[model samples]
Target: MRRRAGVGAIQKHRLEQEKYKEKGTEIQENQFQQMSKQLEVFRENLEDFASKHKSEIRAENALNHMVREGLAWVDSQEPKETLYWFPSMFAECVSA
Candidate 1:
């Protein structure tokens, strides 16, 4: 009788654990879906912003001026650890 009770308790615990694990998986899937929706909206906004700025980006003289200014700022930077992550993240954004 005692051995049977122990087996019953173990079975109950496994059933509870399985139920909770399923709930957790459902919650994670919901969160993932929500995040995907948000990212889709963000991508749409980015596309709109880029389209609105297309001509400004292609204006050669102004583009050259901006590039020169950017280079000058880069030349004056005190080197630190930040350059590593920012560029890689930018690369990821570009690829994505």
Candidate 2:
């Protein structure tokens, strides 16, 4: 009878540990889902801001002018970065 009681206690302890592990995994999954949603929202907001201020953003950055000029010469290749350009050259050429 004593041996049977000891075995039962061990089984109960194991079951409790498994339940705790399952609960922890569920909590982690929920947190990951919430973070993923927030990241998507941030991406959408950034895209919207870029569209609304497209001219200002392009005018403010000199690199955009260079990229725009480079893109015009390329016929087959696609640029890896976003392209922004003003109608005329905004940066002066500096010979080094």
Candidate 3:
């Protein structure tokens, strides 16, 4: 019957719509999980960077303090006469 054909078409259209909706939801969930994992990795990397820099800053501070104490001419006008004027000397100090 023509009426049964129309009803069958409508049912098929509704099922197709439902299938597309479910597929869209699944894709969105997959994308959300991927983003969450990326965010976690980014946070971990940021924390590692912060931790390394914190220790490095502390070490540099201690080295600078030592250098300032060892060479009294660092703050003087004739600082060039001291090792403070040389970039190589500071590099050596930090490396040591």
Top model number, lDDT? 3
Model 1: colliding residue pairs: none
Tell me the tens digit of each residue's lDDT in model 1 across 1-96.
Answer: 344558888999999999999999999999999999999999999999889988876764554665566531223254663121124446678999
RMSD (CA, Å), each prediction: 13.8, 10.2, 11.5
User: Which segments of model 1 are wrong by more than 4 Å?
Assistant: 1-5, 59-96
TM-score rank order: 1, 2, 3
| Candidates' C-alpha lDDT | 0.71, 0.73, 0.78
26-69 per-residue lDDT for model 3 (tens digits): 99999999999999999999999989799888866766876777
Worst window of 10 by summed lDDT in candidate 3: 71-80
lDDT of candidate 2 over 1-96, digit per residue (tens): 344558889999999999999999999999999999999999999999999999899865655455666732223344675545433344434431
In candidate 2, how many Å is residue 21 off?
1.1
Candidates 2 and 3, the one with greater lDDT: 3
1 or 2, which is superior by lDDT? 2
Q: Worst lDDT window (10 residues) for model 2?
A: 87-96
Q: Please state the error at residue 43 of candidate 2 in Å.
A: 0.8
Error of 2 at 74 (Å): 33
